[model samples]
Target: MLKVQEIRELIKLIDHSSIEEFTFEHDGSKIKMKKNTGTSVSVVKTVGQPVEIPSAEVVHKPVVQEVPVEKAATVNAEVIQEKVEIESVTDLHKITSPMVGTFYESPTPDTDAYVKVGSKVSKDSIVCIVEAMKLFNEIEAEVEGEIVEVLVKNGQLVEFGQPLFLVKPE
Candidate 1:
């Protein structure tokens, strides 16, 4: 049986890292855990074989309840205000990464970034570059807008579908 502390620790470990899957095995029992890609935690368990344990027996217990870190951080007025400003500045048409790669805001290190917050852009504008497998793929805006938010920092590894920018329609 899994202890509550173990489960809670596992959850925290998964939440703080980019790993999406984990598994464990012990004493003829196996447990597998996975992080939901859609911003939530889901736990699933499977019993491999029938044991003499009672049907009403609880296999796991809830651990010490920790305050959600992100929620706690957002309770600050400054954080909330910043979030509101970002939302107000843009309707948030997201520009998403088309491939898994390192995101670059400019074509070259010495050049100015292709777009910055508040830069007006057209539908055909190339807003950034994603370098994958040594090839630089120009990321374009599909809608006309003003760039309002940059979701990823320069040189960061971005996964497919990760939002790179938020744009307010012009």
Candidate 2:
């Protein structure tokens, strides 16, 4: 078992890093963490230049104690019928981000958003923009549909494959 303080420290460290996922296992116990992806961790050198570092992990040794033999542990689970109520939800088309970046709802703050709830889009419709490293990339709808939901707010960092909109296909 991990101490609460140790877990807190790890959370804080990961929160400050660009690691998208982390996992640790020891003595039959495991911990997994996933973060909203965006930038990467960088180190500053004497030249005052930033050098990006690849994601890395740190592992700690596990403590163990011998115990007397006993009956094997048994696991129990109960499965209830999940809300099968919305088969229609699976029919909605998802507009996903092509790359990790800052999401933009319009070309500029002064302009109206390209699409909104109930907005009709075509295969070539410019639905939104994604800015990465000062590059503004116009994203297209790629499918004919009516927008049902906008998943992220303007200027929010979006990860690759993150759903940006839900559209009801025309």
Top candidate when judged by lDDT against the true structure: 1
User: Residue by residue across 48-92, what tens digits does model 1's lDDT show?
Assistant: 445333445545422223343354443454555676688775457
CA-lDDT, candidates in order: 0.77, 0.73
Write out the backbone clash pairs for model 1: none
Best-matching candidate per TM-score: 1
Off by over 4 Å in 2: 1-88
Model 2, 37-156: lDDT tens digits are 322222222332232323333344333332222222221111111212222478889999999999999999999999999999999999999998899999999999999888898888
Task: Kindly report which residue stretches of model 1 are placed more than 4 angstroms away from their true locations once superposed.
Answer: 1-65, 68-77, 84-90
lDDT of 1 at 61: 25
| CA lDDT for candidate 2 | 0.73
TM-score of each: 0.57, 0.52
